[model samples]
Target chain A: GESVGLHLPTLSVQEGDNSIINCAYSNSASDYFIWYKQESGKGPQFIIDIRSNMDKRQGQRVTVLLNKTVKHLSLQIAATQPGDSAVYFCAEGRDSNYQLIWGAGTKLIIKP
Target chain B: EADIYQTPRYLVIGTGKKITLECSQTMGHDKMYWYQQDPGMELHLIHYSYGVNSTEKGDLSSESTVSRIRTEHFPLTLESARPSHTSQYLCASSDFMGSRETQYFGPGTRLLVL
Candidate 1:
């Protein structure tokens, strides 16, 4: 089955430094991608998203880079903070589809 | 930031017990979804609804059922919960208008069947 997966199960970053999380998808027909953050004991929260037509999108302190040719996506967060400690998931979907293919998730840990 | 909410953040019940997980969204989105996830695992779609009085099964097969009586309310019911049914259930909604496909999620309900 086509699925989205993370490059690593966990990533550690120093406070005040930048952090990057990588994801790989197997479906080429997917036209939409999104990143979500889930805190402990909480549901997933929307972080950012990008369409296949665009290669990159930026938020307040986050940026999502999509590489359609390689089926890879990456999320970069600047100035990592303790509040940023959570599990991050990447999901892919088609523009006309209602459901998304979710990745297993990668835990982000902040070190002071 | 989203107005979606879920009741009974955590629950511990015995086997063969009937339970209902409540979910509601004030956004009045036309699309709603239910997903089951284990600790540190990926999400599995259990059910979803297109709108009021409209429902459909998701990719994963489950012993649970769902109902969408209004645009803001969607609930999931389990006839008889087993230990294997223990997991975190999440509810989400999205507006079908435009090219926005982002889903806003509720807090989620964690069930522990013993």
Candidate 2:
């Protein structure tokens, strides 16, 4: 499925429950990927990243799963907290340009 | 915990005005990038530089230009601001040359052109 080709506005999710954000990249040669969390009034903070060689990678509280066959990427957060409410972005490495291609962010919300 | 910094966190300028957003890093990174983002949206790469005196335009067609005079400094300039140019500009740096390198970002400069 073509996932990351379009640019959208926002995303909303609840707190406490697990949160899953999805991204679909356009390029197939993109070998590396990263997830970033941006809080209000702050710059993006690195979450986790995965290379083409791996299908899944886990961090302190986040996990990144990559499906190269479909060019799909996902970020999963356990026990989402209010402080976790922010915009999450997915980025990829451009094989030809040596730059990262970014996806439209998914805004995670923590509904009290 | 990134040492990158962007000045004039917020700016409101009139159309046709010339503006420059400054970005600097103390991490001594070799790769730097400039991205234009609307509030909470995808980041469009505007420009990038691999090292001093090296720069290249990005995927998005941008009216802004950037310069890399020093390894740690990559500033973007809009010759003439317009309403369409109103957006948040973010600066990032990376250690380039590593197979797995992370890009650290600055707080960003929010520009509102009226």
Candidate 3:
């Protein structure tokens, strides 16, 4: 059974500080990984993604790092702000049908 | 920001009642998906469609059925809703370019079966 899981259920960080959310995946065959942000009462929004061929990818102030050796994925948000307070999720995509295996979300809270 | 839309943002219905969740996308994406999520829980894929007239069941087993007669519209129908079906339903659409496929989601529908 393939599954994705988060290291922490909730993470608290101060504003203007960097935040790191970690995820672990069980499938070695998964080649694509994605990060999504879900605001309260809203659907998840795409943040960043990384392919197995690459080690890291950056988008705006967000960065995604993938370590295929350890089957780990991380999302780095620089200068965490109040707007960054949301639930973050990591998903792994297999070759078939492009369906993604989602993990339990990590709630990122920014302290004022 | 995605053009995807879901109707009946909040619904409260009795058990055994019929209900339908509407989902539509203006992006002309070839892929569409329906996901169920409980509060503070992981998302479970319930249904997905590759294109018009092509629908498939996802990883999770669901009692609801879906129809994709038009490219932009994909709706889910629950013939006999139950209390166990109470949850948030999200709709998403994606268009892949080569190996890059990103799903854009809509504001989910919150269903409460009383």
Q: Report lDDT per candidate.
A: 0.93, 0.85, 0.93
Clashing pairs in 1: none
Clash pairs for candidate 3: none
Could you tell me every candidate's TM-score relative to the true structure? 0.97, 0.92, 0.97
lDDT by residue for model 2 over B1-114, one digit each (tens)?
A: 999999989999999999999999999998999998997788888999999999999878879899999998899999999999988899999874456767899999999999
For model 1, residues B12-83, the per-residue Cα lDDT tens digits are 999999999999999979999999999878999999999999999998887999999999999999999999
Number of the top-ranking candidate, with DockQ as the measure = 3
Model 1 chain B poorest ten-residue lDDT run: B94-103
In candidate 1, stretches whose alpha carbon ends up further than 4 angstroms from where it belongs are none
Q: Candidate 3 on B27-82: residue-level lDDT in tens?
A: 99989999999987899999999999999998788799999999999999999999
lDDT of 2 at A2: 23
DockQ of each: 0.77, 0.69, 0.78
Give the Cα error of residue A5 in candidate 3, in Å.
0.7
Candidate 2's displacement at residue B65, Å, is: 1.8
Superposed model 2: Cα runs more than 4 Å off: A1-12, A94-97
Report the C-alpha lDDT of model 1 over A38-67, residue by residue, as the tens digit.
999888998998888999999999999999
Clash totals for all models, in order? 0, 1, 0
TM-score of chain A of 1: 0.98
